[model samples]
Target: MAAQPGGRRGPARGPSKGAAGGQARGQVRRSWLGGVRDAIDGLVRSSPARFAILVFATLVLITTALLSLPLARAGAGTGGTPLYDAFFTAVSTICVTGLTTVDMATHWSPFGNTIIFIGMNVGGMGVLTLASILGLVISRRLGLRAKLMAASDTNPSRVHAGPVSERQAVRLGEVGGLLVTVAVSTLSIEAVIMLGMVPSVMAKGHDFGLSLWYSAYYAVSAFTNTGFNPNPLGPAEFFDDYWFQSLMMLAVFLGSLGFPVIFALLRTWRSPRRWSVHVKLTLTTTIVLWIAGAMTFLVLEYNNPKTYGSFGFVKTFYEAFFMSTMTRSGGFSTIDMADLYGSSLLVTDMLMFVGGGSASTAGGIKVTTLAVLFLAAYAEARGAPAMEAFGRRIPRDILRLAVSVVLWGATIVAVSTVIIAQITKSALDFVLFDVISAFATCGLSTGLTESLPPEGKYVMAATMFMGRVGTVTLAAALAAAQKRQLFRRPEERPIVG
Candidate 1:
């Protein structure tokens, strides 16, 4: 092609046209590079909440990919599990739910177990939060997006107030301190339990090395609220050991209570009279729930032959405590859950639905949200203008958010349970339990997970993700589509019972 400008020879015009074409290509290349640079900058400076969600999604994807690999599946027993099982397992791990489609001990090799353990750690701590923490440790400065992401992960509403520089720093410090404390406490307790379990495990004629491995695996698994057992050995063999069961129960209990609650207790311990309202409420609710659940389990299963199964009164109480605590989120089982009677199953479902505390590894709607809702209801009942708990008035916005979260969570669980039941043709109780287990990220099941159809598996996977990130967080991310308007619609009253 020739340029059609000015008075110029055709031959001269041809060179000019070529020069223009070269310049145009150069401009296009520069524009493409500029676009790429802008994208990188945008990603780096993206909203922390968005960044966190992205990171979490990426981690889950990576986990799913790894679990799908033939090499990863190698030696995981009987060659490899179904792709659905692997995917479900990966989702369960990333969601920090202990539910398993396959018996972990008989199926996975040591490497697979390690992958699971790491996934547990990452899941327990928010993936983005952990990444941000690591970045802070190495760089000593958080990017703008990292700070915002930290705030969102810890408390999303706080991000709306302003730039969360100081708050992010404080929250990050708290998280780091909490992790260190949990690690130390978990290791110490596990070490003691390992020592205790060694004798018992060795007594069963297992080799010392294998016994040690089992002890370590159980220790980490229990504390992480991961119900995985490295040994295919059933609970029947260890059921009679009171001390072992008690030790495991304690680990599960501590693990179920979120790290923030633990840290709050520790801080209160340092100054007995000056506990924060949050600390007091969390401790009180936790203690009350534990005692009430244990008692309820014992009373409900007292005459039932399946669960108590001809045990003495003392043994009954011990088993009851284990069941209650495990149902809270631990997923560990000293008894076959399938053996539990109808009443006992209902009680366990209630416990699983209530779940553990906020900002912790444990899921469910969260104790804090529950507390807030109850307090809000009480305030309305008493004709009070504001919601108060433990002498502190919870902000109306927070209360609204809490209620929304609980409702949304319940709805998700309910819908998913229906879908799962339809897909699997399982009994309502077992399917509901599985749905609750996924929603609470608790992982306990009545052996229904493996039997679930692929559709049911997908439902559980979605439930697990929602439980981990939380309904409110997901809602907020999705709610960004709603634009702000200068004018508000008039409030209207609706008829009600």
Candidate 2:
């Protein structure tokens, strides 16, 4: 040892060099991690859409990896699940889009099924919403940016430039309560649905334990609008079980209504006048679509012989109603979708394309979007300057956003259908049906999904991802990439359609 500057004696030189080197490495690692954390936080604060997409994509990747494991597959020594199937299933599960390339009942092990169950619940909770909830739990409160993001989950327009109106589906100050509502509502609703279905499942010849498992699976699937069946026979086993079908329909309807609407209804149940315009529009439009779709189905398929024709009037009506409900992102079916008339398929396509409510587990352009567009058309025909719904004049910007969402959704569906159609060369009708199903995340299929080529599956998987992440959110994320201008270009009318 030797004397060192400002020290009595030198620490052993060899040990000192190693310790200094270790300290430098640790500092570098800490700095790197800190940089990564800052980047993530910056993303979360800057654009909630991109952050939500990143989180969802990461979740899908993790789910895919789990499903790829050998243990995730059924049958001893069957080897690891195929990448295409695992990846597709991962997207389907995490998106709560139940389209599957493989048989749900025979393909996955218990571990795999558990992963799907958990993933569906997580995915059913909107991505931005889950992130905000986690942030609130970790930090004991949400920051301004976190609240803004959560508000965006409830109202996509909240993230737009300019001050948001106090009138919102879920306001900034109420974001914390909204997050709590999301968690509490999801768990409570699912539990109730699960309990309700257990006895019906037990009556279907299963023991209490098996019935409980099936009931729990169906509860999560139904509420999430996931459409997965644990049984070998699928929905066919319950085609005549009115109680099971009714409960399932109830769960699907509630789940499709979106959390904000649920929050609104719960808060304003006593006073109908206190209900927000969004609540009014979503409920009215959804009910109208449900009934209209049922009638259309009954008309189109009543004489098809293979479908509704075999059943009597009551059975036909019930089945028509069930199918109509399922088409709105519910994904369950009691009969073969391929057996429907072409006209019925076209009608189903229209219904599924409209999908459920905004910020809900179900996807598509969203019911609010359809309502806004329809109102816009109605107002235009009346030569009105603004769209009005439930006595509230909808702003032009909201109309613009609604149009953008529908256009974006239609474009995505068209592109996906063409790509998948080119890949498989299947009949155009079935191909279109399944493509719309994937794009809407509605999960209905005309036997096209299971038989799609690998490339087609990939396209459908991407479609499902886009549909679940939302057209509006994706558009917002894209728009956020551009720098904001201090001035606007002069508006000009181009041409009439």
Candidate 3:
């Protein structure tokens, strides 16, 4: 240290100017961090899409973990299948697909059933939206990415363009409130249905405890568009019970109608003349689809012995209604889906392909997308300048998105069907039905699920996940990797038929 350098006395004694400079830099970093903290505090808010995805993923993980537990296995009484079965079941539930390897009634314990019920609810409400609410409640700060993601997920056109800070805050509040209201209403309706069914279930010779369990399980399942049933006896036991079936159908239909329709109804209740155009369109499309689907199925299967089975006209009508309702995203089946004639199967496949409405627990290409695509096509056919529906002009971008979503969804199902056929050597009809069911998160099976190999099951699992998360989401994520400059190039024409 005697001749270290001509620096400060303290630095010359032990260190040099470099050490003091490093200390100063550390202090500056601390100060900078403090400023960053302040900036973050100002920008803190919830992100609905991120929240929904995170929650969905977390629930899937938790469900898997619970199913893997020793207690859960013991309750099943045969080692409860393998890790993959549980993992797939968890994913299916979180995705709101009712497909299952093991029957819920015969295999899972009450606790396990409860977990499934929760999964359905979580999936129905949307995991990302739920998670965003949680983050808002906890820290009152949602990242910008979360907000942008939420906007993308929920349709950014709906987002208001106010002051940046104000708009985000408003959106958070509105979405949070809307989600809570929908969830509450859904649970309430399910509770009422459960209570109503308890008596019917008891009358069918089920014990009080069993009846209660079955009623609750069915209620949750129906209300979330999850086709899982707590009764091992299957739909046969309830086939003759008109009231029970009706209640189940109602719950399923209501659940599959999508949250936007529900919100529209609520808004109408509050102010009849104030219903938004989206609400009006959603209700009209939903009602029309319901009628069309029900009528088609009724006509197609009215005389089919496998479907109607010589039941009275009333029962036949009820079963047709049930099938129509269930096929639009609900997985419940009053008759054996495998026994349907080729025509009936084709009708069902079409219904499942169109799916339920947007922003609903139900899946498929989404009724709104189908509706928009049809409108756009019709306009083009008529040589009209704009796409119109419910007396309002539908934006070109929205129409394009709808078309994209449908094409992507159809492609996914087609590819998945081919892959499943290769793996299982199943007939094309059954394999296609299974693929569509999984892709739509409809949960209905043509008995192929039990016969599927591990690879087949995996394929179905992937389809279910994609169906629930949305083909558009997956497509966007893939496209994001190839992002380029916003500058547009000159348009070029391509040959077409």
Sorted on lDDT, best first, the list reads 2, 3, 1
Candidate 1: where is the Cα deviation over 4 Å?
1-45, 74-79, 134-140, 143-145, 159-199, 481-488
Ranking 1 against 3 by TM-score, winner: 3
lDDT of 2: 0.88
Tens-digit lDDT string for candidate 3 (78-118) = 66557778888998888888998877776776667778888
Which one wins by TM-score: 2 or 3? 2
Worst lDDT window (10 residues) for model 2?
6-15
Q: Write the per-residue lDDT of candidate 1 for residues 292-327, one digit (tens) a residue.
A: 998998888888776685889998988888777788
Q: Give stretches of model 3 more than 4 Å off.
A: 1-55, 74-77, 141-153, 156-173, 270-273, 481-486
After best superposition, candidate 3 residue 332: deviation in angstroms? 0.6
Cα-based lDDT for every prediction = 0.72, 0.88, 0.74
Give RMSD to native, each candidate: 7.8, 4.3, 7.3
Q: Comparing 1 and 3 by lDDT, which wins?
A: 3
Candidate of highest lDDT: 2
- Cα lDDT tens digits for candidate 2, 246-286: 99999999999999999998998999899988888889999
Per-residue lDDT value at 206 in model 3? 91
Question: Which pairs of residues have clashing backbones in candidate 3?
Answer: 44-141, 45-141, 45-142, 51-128, 51-132, 52-127, 52-128, 52-129, 53-128
